[model samples]
Target: MTTPVEPPVPPADTAPPRPGRKLGPIADGVGSVHRAWLEPLRHTYLTSGLTLSDLSIRVPLAKSKISELLRGCGLYPRWEIMHSLSIQLQLPSWPLHRLWRQAAFEAQKSSEWVERSGDKAAVTTSLVPPLDHRAFRETVESDYSLYAQVFLDDDQRDTAVSNAFDILWLRWNEALASPDIRRFAWEALRATVMARTPHIDGRPEFGAAAFDTVALQHLTTETERMDQMAESLHLFKAMSWLPDRQLDVMVMRRLYGTSPEAVSDLLGLSLATVRSDERHANHFLQSVICPTPETEGKTA
Candidate 1:
């Protein structure tokens, strides 16, 4: 019998590219809403081993359009395209639909436009939130509301907190996979509130907000009020200069009277780290607001 000859193996350099290899990372400077949904879609596409051609066939989008979507280039995609892509990728459609709506709003698309396009997508899911998500919201809502109210009116504070929860819902899978869900949630909440907060000289401006603080509002005598206002101004200025983590610790521990253990849990920090941050913040504020002769001389 004649011996069979095997074909030569291709060199690694000349081998065919892996599925989805041409899909680049999402473009920089995409808005948060775009980043939030694009990341998971990209991840799902990569893992699904689907190439652009395959996706184009399955998603009713052109290959070039699919490429643009994966890279976050071109115009913000409509809900119909996103829904079709999500179905092909086997991703949950509800979160993507919500994120699409938010992105549409960010893009200055009107409610009528969103509703009309959403009608085209024809996506529907239960209105009820997941039990764990609801529990997480309940657990953090009080502290988050209080913190936001420090920088915003009641209406604005509620809106910020609600938006934060919506963001968390969009990234629920990633949050669950994170090392600390509390820290993830805290960051989302902080970003949402700060995006609406007024800043001066790159620091959060507290002048007007501080005047409305419960501590300041409760002062009775003029002398006491004047003294308190002066001290508070100095304190808030110094507090603004504190590093972000230390500032958070100080706000929770001193301003809100949260226990170290609770602050630790809330911030996803260890108790020791919380205590250390508290001590450091206290020392820094003291040095700034009440410098001794030696410190004053050094600064001078």
Candidate 2:
């Protein structure tokens, strides 16, 4: 009798076919999935004890393509390719699917921007930059001193500064990698400060007083200074009530000392829009703080 033939067994680590999981709609933004992919993919590949070449053979994809997936270089693979790899690597479908979606979105966004700007270099690379905490701390700490003068108590200032730095450090690498350096830096610190200050949620009040103090230092008349201070305080308080977009523009202009042109660029708005928002915010504040005769009569 002929020897019975045994069936070929799949590799021991090969993921068995499981019930297919449905993927959720892809999230917007470039790093949405890329950040999620980095750790899980690395850990799974390492645990499988497979080399790059071996993985290519098993997945039946080119080595370069495998490297792209592994590195999350912002190049998305098709759903079929992702499905095949999901089975081969035994990774959770959601992670791979999400990665594919983010990469695809980023690729499309980059393509459109490149067409508009005609500048290939404007497209951001996936390479993460090294963070220099010492440098960042040195630069921000002095600014934080001015910050402390307004909101933070003497004892709480250092602690708040440390905490703010800790929170911002999380996004430091990402900020360094982005093309919009000024806006990224401004936003990172703004977010950190907002998170720490619960009382004035979106108002940039802490530094506003400092800017006002400097600009108003030359006023010799105590009466004039007092009037200005009152007006400033009223405007500052009114900031908490302003619409979100108008508040952003007003704070960037009056508090942060950013020019209207810079505000326009930072906010991705036209100069006219920035100025108009500033005017609207100022008018609203005036209506509340220094009401006209008609508004007073109406209130009466």
Candidate 3:
């Protein structure tokens, strides 16, 4: 019989077990817009050759949870997970955060939920607020508060503004490095406020607070008040239908009396653009609220 039979050698293609499974395609449930950022993340993972196990070790998530995130499975993962993953993947967190925020909204997560999750995540990783951030807050806080108050109660306004500031604080390094910090901060504030602002037919609903404006507070007679209220409602409805840039311009210039130059700087728009938007917005409103006889004839 036999010389001892040599143990069979494994095939050359048989390799050692990988550290973890490779990422698969994003789930079909993930929207195309979401895929915009998720694709980059998947590419980063693939190129880095970091396995699911690697992400679990780097981020605090479990291996299964990390896998679900990369594949866009299950509920939208928290901002904490996204933020940590961004850090590990060496992706710039600021742009990722913006996309993640949008995804969170699409996922039906409330603004309060987003704010709370972000606050909890930030607490663990937060550093001292940079001096420039503090200075920036001081410059914009009052106006931001007033703007938010248009859509929220005093307490809610304070919370919204504070949450915006917190977001800016977390991303201040990126903000400072950007070409225009004012515009960056303004966007953060706007996003925070708009997330909380109620919508009707996919438009920001300002009619609820129409009665609260200073313009309406001085009317003494019931008839004058009712007429003004009707006009105010019409005006606010018209404003709601304005394109976002025009609405922003009208709100700042007409409601807050901000100068056009200031609106340009805050919105990261050119002065000419801001002025044009305001003019277009006014024309749209006048057409809606007080159509000229010639326009009325055309409609007739």
TM per candidate: 0.79, 0.42, 0.65
**What tens-digit string does per-residue lDDT give for candidate 2 at 190-218?**
44344445465545444346335544677
Best by lDDT: 1
Candidate 3: list runs displaced more than 4 Å: 1-53, 60-64, 70-127, 293-300
Cand. 3 TM to true fold: 0.65
lDDT (10s digit) by residue, model 3, range 83-174: 78878876656656666776787788999988877764553333346687787788778878877877787776886687677667656655
Best by TM-score: 1
In Å, residue 16's CA in model 2 sits off its true spot by 18
**Which residue pairs in model 3 clash with each other?**
none
Error of 3 at 146 (Å): 1.8
Which pairs of residues clash in candidate 1, taking residues 3 or more apart in a chain or in different chains? none
lDDT scores in order: 0.76, 0.54, 0.73
Q: In candidate 1, what are the lDDT values of residues 1-300, reduced to their tens digit?
A: 111222343342322456544767788778766665776677667666678888878887889988998888998888888889878876667767877787788778899888887677776677556789999888779988877876778887887787778777766776776666787788888877777778888887655555655566678998888788777777877788878789878777766778888888777776788889999889878877779987776533
RMSD of every prediction: 11.2, 20.1, 15.9
